[model samples]
Target: MKLYISLLLAAICCNWALAQSDPLTVATFNIRYDNPNDDPHTWDNRKDVVANLILFHEFDIFGIQEGLSHQVNDLDVRLPDHDFVGVGRDDGAEEGEYTAIFYNRTKFKVQESDTFWLAPETDHPNKGWDAALPRICTWAKITSVNAGQTFYVFNTHFDHRGVEARNQSARLILEKIEEINTESLPVILTGDFNVGQETEAYQLLRTAPGMKDTFDAAEIVYANNGTTNSFDITTSTERIIDHIFVSEKINVQKYGILTDTYHSRFPSDHFPVMAVVNW
Candidate 1:
C-alpha cells in the first residue's frame, strides 16, 4: 500500500509538470456582420454555435471582426465569464461594427484597453483614403493569472474595398504597435485583412518589424485547411485573408483553422484560426 501511494504521487507530479508545458491557445474569428437579409443564416440562428466554438476550444485570448453592438452583447450574454475591449467604428460607442478583443476573465486580469480609428481622424469615427466606411482597431493590455505574463492585443478589420486604405491602415497599425509596444513586450495583432498573403500589407506584416506569422513560425501546423468560407455553404478560400501575428517573444507550438459546422450549417462565414504558443 505504501509503494502504491508513492507511485501515484509520482504520476501526479509528472502530469502536473506536463500540464505546465501546455501552450496558451489564441484564436481569431470573424463572426460575419448581423445582416437582416441573411435570414436563415442570421446571427440569431447561429450565435449559439459561434459561442460554443469559443467555449469548446477554450481560447485564452481571441479577436473578433465585424461584430455589431447587439452581436457583441449577445456573445457577452451567451459566453459569460469573458471581458472585451472595443468601440463602435462609426462613433466609438454602440454605433457600428466593432473589431473587438476578448480575453477569458478567469485566465487573465485586464490592465488597460483602447480603441482607435484607422484614419486621419484616428481619434474620431471617420474614413480614411477612400475607405468605404469607418474602420478601427480595439486593443488591450492583459496579464495572465496562471502564468503571470503580460501582453498587448490589437484587433482590427481593414477596409475591404480600398486598396490604398488597406495598405495605409497596415502602416498606421505598425506605427501604433511600435509606440505602444515600446518595451517590445509580447504583442499579438489579429484581423480580417481582406487581402491575400501576396499583398504589400500582408508582406509588411510577415516581414518588417519582427512580428512572426503564427502559421509560419509554428513548430507544428496541426490544422489550417483555410480561414475563409463564404456563406454559400459550398464556397471556401485558400487565400486565407484573415490572420494572427505574434511578436518574436512567443514560441508557436501549433497552428490550426477551426472549421466546424452544426448539422450542415456553419457558425460563421469565416473559419476561426488559432495558435498555441508559449513565451
Candidate 2:
C-alpha cells in the first residue's frame, strides 16, 4: 500500500512538472489618453522612448488600453516587426479610443480579431458607457510560430465609474469566454480592470474555474509586490490596477510590473504589467 501511494505521488509530481514547462510571454499596458497635462513628457512626443521600452521587454503579445487609432498606427510604424489589430471605440469611424493588441509577427500569427463595447445596451461595436466616453475589449486568436499552438487573448479596459458597468462587464467577458473559447485552448485575459484586488470584478475573475491570476501563481517565485499604477501623474505612486490572468491550463513562469521610470517620463499614466507563461 505504501509503495503504491508513493508511485501515485511521483506520477502526479511529474505531471505537474511537465505542465510548468510551456513557454510564452504577455504584457498589458493602459496608455492613458493623450492629454496635455503630460506635456513635454507625453506619449506623442516620446514615441521612440515608449517603443524602446516596449521592445526591450520582448513580449510575445502586448495589449494596450486607451489607444487611439493614430497611436496604434504609430506603434505599428515604430514596431514594424509586430502585427496588431483593433477598431475604434466608436463604431468603425476610428474616431474614439481603443483597446488594442500587438503580437510579434515573428512569434505569432493573428488568426482572428474583434472588439466589443461595454454598455448595458451594447449592441453596436463601440458606444460610450455612462461614466467614461466608451470602453472596448479586444480579442485575438493567435497561432504560435514556433510551437504552432493556438490560444485566445482577450484585453479590455473597464469603465472608471459605474460600478454596475464594471460588474456587468466582468460577467459579459466571462460569458464571451465560454461562448468563444470552446476549443479548450489556453487563454490569457489582460487589461486594466480599474478595480483593486478586492472588487467584485476582481473576485469574479480570480475565482472563475480554469482561470488563475498570474500574480498569485508567480508571487512565490518573484518578489514583485507592485504590479501596476496608472494614476498619479506626478509622483507615480505604485498601485496595482493592470492584470494578466491566464487559464489553469497555462503555466505561469515569471511576472512583474514594469516601473522603468527613467525612459517613461509620461508614456502613459499606468505602468505596464508583464508575465511569462507556458502551455
Candidate 3:
C-alpha cells in the first residue's frame, strides 16, 4: 500500500509539471541582418543554423525581424513545409528588411496577410516620427487546421534610435490590434523593440487591457527574463529588447529564451524568445 501511494504521488507530480509546460510553441528571433560588414557573423553563415534551430524546437508559429528578401527566401527553401507572410519595408516591395511571420502549413492555414508601415501614412512606406528607417509590421490571420480556430499574429522591428518612434509605434500597433480583433480571438505580437521592458514603448503596449507579456503571464518562465545577449556578454540583467505578447484570450503556459551556442558561435546577435500558449 505504501508503494502504491508513492507511485500515485509521483504520477501527480509528473502531471503537474506537464500541465505547466505549454503545447503550442511560438518564437521571435531577430537575426541581425545580412550585412557584408558582419563577415564572420553573416546571414549566409548562420541561415541554415537558424533553420535547424527552428526545426529542433518544432515551434508552431514564429516571427523573424530584420530578415531580408534573400534571407526569407533561404528560409523558404530550408523550411519548405512552413508558410511565411510579410513584405519589405521599402516601397512595399522586396527592397528592404522584412518582419516575416512563419507558421507550419500543416497545422495552420493563412486567412489573410499584409504589411503596414509604422508611420503617419500607414498605407505607404513612410518613416514615422524620427525613425531611422521605414519600419513596418507584418500581420497574418491564420486558422488552425484541426480545431478550425482563427487568430492573428503581428511581427515587427521598432526603430533602434528613435524614442518617439518606438512609443508611437506601440500606439499604432495597439490601434491595429483593436482594428484586427472583431472576433475576440487570440492575438500574438512578437518583435525586436530595441528597448528594454521598463520603457515607454513597453508601457504603451501594456496599456492594452487584453494584452500581456507572455513571460509575465506564463505559469512557468523556463528560460527566465533578459532575452537578448550582446554576443560578448554571457548574461546581463538589462539586455532584453525582444519580446512576445499575447491577448487575454490566450493563456500563457511557458516562456523561455533560446540560449544555445555552437562552437562558441551564436546564430545571431540577439537571442530569440519563445512561449507556449493555450487558445
On TM-score, the leading prediction is 1
Residue 270 of candidate 2: its Cα lDDT?
71
Per-residue CA lDDT of candidate 2, range 101-178, in tens? Answer: 899998789998888777665557544445455777889999977667899999998888877778878888888888
The residue ranges of model 2 lying beyond 4 angstroms of the native Cα positions read 1-22, 123-130, 219-238, 263-266
Cα lDDT tens digits for candidate 1, 166-250: 9999999999989887778889889998888889989888886678899899998855456777765676667778899999877
Cand. 3 Cα-lDDT: 0.87
lDDT of 2 at 105: 95
Better of 1 and 2 by TM-score: 1
Model 1 global lDDT (CA atoms, 0 to 1): 0.87
Clash tally, candidates in order: 0, 3, 0
Greater TM-score among 1 and 3 belongs to: 1
Residue pairs with colliding backbones in model 3 are none
Residue 11, model 2, lDDT = 100
lDDT of each: 0.87, 0.79, 0.87
Query: What's each prediction's TM-score?
Result: 0.91, 0.86, 0.89
